[model samples]
Target: MSEALWQPSASVELLKQRSEIISKIRHFFYQRQVMEVDTPALSQACVSDIHLHSFCTTLSGPAAPKTMPLYLQTSPEFHMKRLLAAGSGCIYQIAKAFRNEEAGRYHNPEFTMLEWYRVGYNHFALMDEMEQLLELVLGCGSCERLSYRQAFERHLGFNPLEAEHVQFMVAAKELGVADLVAKEPERDTILQLLFSLGVEPHIAQQRPCFVYHFPASQAALAKISSTDPQVAERFELYYKGIELANGFHELTDAQEQAERFANDQAYRKVNGLAEAELDQRFLAGLAAGLPACAGVALGIDRLLMLAFGQTHIQQVQSFSIERA
Candidate 1:
């Protein structure tokens, strides 16, 4: 075991840089009149995504002596949506989110997230907002927009929408991605691997790029596009090949959302993963009627890295998992 002291060298210059970036982000939101909010870190329920493993703990107290399962929220999305349903227009939050089984140059189990929602806005409008936010935070004049299909075509020499499973498998092998096809035999998994390995590396480096209109199979909680039934109204922001944010056109149908969550739970059960408790409150909020809105969750640490042109996330953060 390594017993090295894990103190980080926080130079005054770098700290000042971090502060300036944070201030700029806050000012951008303030200019838009987006109300900043806070929510609980611990929750009774957690995300149902099979790919994401949340950190769970037993809550022990006089009122809860039996030790109930509490999970560190992967994102503040659900609670924020509830607030939206309650008629809070245009909200944003910069908070610490926790996830398990993530530790790397670009990842940490515990990290900061910047999430925001715009009321009565569609996915396209949100895409524009993302561009402006990037310009404001990074102090760039303009950013580029690329659809998922276009990005795949430009970088991988194939359209992601029409690619076959065999082609994706072959590409994964060429990219040296281990266990890519074995984990999930679905085409979406293969496409994701190809994007992560092949296409993502070639995105705009100096300016942020918004990749929009993802395939329907990749839509976790977003609404499917009416114009293109094959694609969902989802977009992800990438800077210099690194994914910084994921945005979605909010899905308002409670029944359909519940069905999707059930499907995710079933997938988890089949894969021998722990089941996530359903967030009945969120479902209730949806049933009560949520406005037409779009929201996004951005990686604050990754943004910091981009702002400073840092190679690794550990450079900006006070302490990483290895150091801890």
Candidate 2:
């Protein structure tokens, strides 16, 4: 007989590891004096990024307006930053986040995100702490740090930040993914495609790698370097060719942040994507002088998959979406 739909794909032992790792994570933060925080799962404002799709629900109870739309958080970033603005120092959260997407080997619609921030830390400093966390959390050995330009030059034979049109097309042709290069796209878009198709699959073959100094266009909330204005102080962690986390030296300029949000909303509108609530509260927090900090969000389920020596995310999750 076919297995019952209510059954979980993950074994009991895997569930045990999930619990143990969560305990260890809390201890890890506790030892560092980083306070564990909790934030609302649903909110009036949501991520405005064009790439992320947030799940939404209509409120029906007395606690909220009738039929008011509440978007499930994709991450606890905005709320955490607000806390920073309120003078809360160095906080972390093991949060449940939702994103609208297809189920696959590596993805599920809802997942656990372990997010943290460090007051007065740069992206590089955060990366160092992350390496230590990996050693504790995943028993990872050794780490390699590579700048965006270095990685591109080594893998694709081009400097991503300075590549002009002709150079971009040449690199694409060299990588045998010329067709994957979108038509007349932005410079960063082409660079991103090349990174994903050419470089990413070959990264961190034996050791965790921290790729840093991304192009400013791809910074997200990261701060652009004062010395190198074209580069953003952002980094992503990879292990065994798997992207595990992303961190940034956050941008604290309120006016610049407002402009970036407006730009993202405009981009969403132009691309025919639904616009999220503008997160005015988050903007207000920025105006209130948020602390200088670096923050990261790590995928807990993916980390568990690595810890359990599993090939698919389902093998580590208690229940896949289909089972739920």
Candidate 3:
């Protein structure tokens, strides 16, 4: 191994800048009376999202006769929501999140996440707050907003909301990703490829761009739009072609949430992925009643990258996955 592996990935100057930016973020939320919170990084239940992978460990010692499996949280959404159910209103957390995924230019197995929830606010309201924070920290001016359909239409010359599976197949072929899609042949998979490969690159790089109203099938924890059942009230922020944040209008219906979890399980089984145990505590929180709110999870490393005009995520992190 290289001796340089012992060193931090980020420079001292960059680390100082990262600290200042986080301070600014905290101040921004403090001015709005959003309470900062802390949650456990480990949980007995893991996320059911098919696209996300959680790191697992076994708990031993006198806690139980047999070792119990636990998973590192990919995000702190569930724990924060439970707090909301218990009347902890307007909360935010700058916490470490772990994902058992490949590390790349924009991804690290472990990264910092800034998550916040605003009670009685919808996704659009949350987007407004997000834009304000970006303007304050990144000084990017006002952000542009576009519906998911509009983004696809403007960039790919087709409206994704109305497109058929065959159209996506044709588009994938046209975009030179047909081989990649052939392995999955799923509509959402193809759409994601088309978005990342075809559309994301074309989004505004100098400023934040919010893409809202994603297809219902892609909704992880968001509520389905009341006016349109085909779409969910979810939004994703992208800056410099990098996904920086994801927000959702909170879904409080326990039955709907349970069904979504089951759908994830079925998809995992079909895809030969491990079936994750359901987060019954979170579901119970929903069943007991959670306040109307919208919440978002933003990548702190990616935000720092944008602020410092850096390309690789490691440039803003103290250590990359390799060094960690």
Query: Estimated TM-score per prediction?
Result: 0.93, 0.96, 0.97
Q: Using lDDT, give the best candidate's number.
A: 3
Ranking by lDDT: 3, 2, 1
Task: Please write out the lDDT profile of model 3 over residues 1-324, one tens digit for every residue.
Answer: 999999999999889989998999999999999999999999999999988999999999999569999999999999999999999989999999999989999999999999999999999999999999999988899999999999999888888877877777777888887778777767788788899988899897767899999999888899999999989999999988889999999899999999999999998999899999889999999999999999999999999988898999999999898898
Which prediction has more favorable lDDT, 1 or 2? 2
* Backbone clash count for every predicted candidate, in the order shown: 0, 0, 0
The C-alpha stretches of model 3 lying farther than 4 A from their native spots are none
Can you give the lDDT of residue 294 in candidate 2? 97
Worst 10 residues of 3 by lDDT: 178-187
Question: Candidates 1 and 3: which is better by TM-score?
Answer: 3
* lDDT scores in order: 0.86, 0.89, 0.92
Expressed as tens digits, the lDDT of each residue in 1-324 for candidate 1 is: 555444652345776888888888889999999999999998898888888888888988996988899889999999999999999999999999998976887889988899999999998898888888777778776778889999888887777788876666667777887465756677777888788878888887777788899998888889999889889999998888688999999999999999999999988888798888888898999999889999999999898888887888878877777766
Top-scoring candidate (TM-score): 3
| Model 2 local distance difference test score | 0.89
Instruction: Give the residue spans of candidate 2 off by over 4 A.
Output: 182-184
